[model samples]
Target: MAYIFLDESGHLYTQIIGEILEMYTPTTDLDFRVFCDQRHLKGITRAQFKEMLRTRLLPLLPKGAILQIEMIDSTTNANIQIADWITGALAKYLEKQKWGEEYYSILKNNIIGEGKELFKDYWVEAKTNKKLESK
Candidate 1:
């Protein structure tokens, strides 16, 4: 069993990445590349992020599947920039904005996976526990 310590984003990010990557598991010989937007990360160094991902990912990837992680600057990458726009549009759509609704309607059918809130109560429980500890 591997142990990984996560702070804030690492916890949720790990679960999300784990859920998505499980679909593309490669054997020990092939490399599976995961690209993440480094700008969105808070309170964690890139090294910590990599370690957090490795611990969770290594177990799932076996045989030919080598995990290759690239923490990229969203500003410089066109793909990442487009992704940021899509995310913004999705958020706006959720907020019931007209512009967002237009973009979202075009992309809605092409979206993949269930966007269920994983570990939804985790932050609430964590905050409550911290308050108890402080008192």
Candidate 2:
């Protein structure tokens, strides 16, 4: 009787864990772009952009230690106004696209297991290009 009880409990635990693992697979990659004039590229620096991400965005991760953000590509111009605009636009896009809510769900679910670090390593490698308008 004792052995049967232990076996059943263990099986139940294993099944629960399996169900959880199955629910939160790696999220799909997201990509979008916004176009602005040369005047918009005045004040944003790469360092400041990264810092903004770390402070404004990184906290959304469920487990900071396990989940990390790796930016593969980000292009910024020297204009502060442009930087601000870009930041605001990004915030708007994320909100419009339901990223904030999805991120919250990820946190609440406590998804990702042993391979979380691997997922983090490849999370957001963006590619960007800049074009100059000819008058």
RMSD of each predicted structure: 5.8, 23.5
Candidate 1 at residue 121, lDDT? 88
Model 1: per-residue lDDT, tens digit, 15-87? Answer: 5666666655545546778887775555567776778778767887765566788878889998988888888
Off by over 4 Å in 1: 1-7, 26-29, 112-135
Question: TM-score of model 2 relative to the true fold?
Answer: 0.21
- What C-alpha lDDT, on a 0 to 100 scale, does residue 117 get in candidate 1? 64
1-135 per-residue lDDT for model 2 (tens digits):
111224444433333323333344342423211222222212444344334334433343344324233333224544545545445554555556646555545454553455323223332432112222321
What is each predicted model's overall lDDT from 0 to 1? 0.74, 0.37
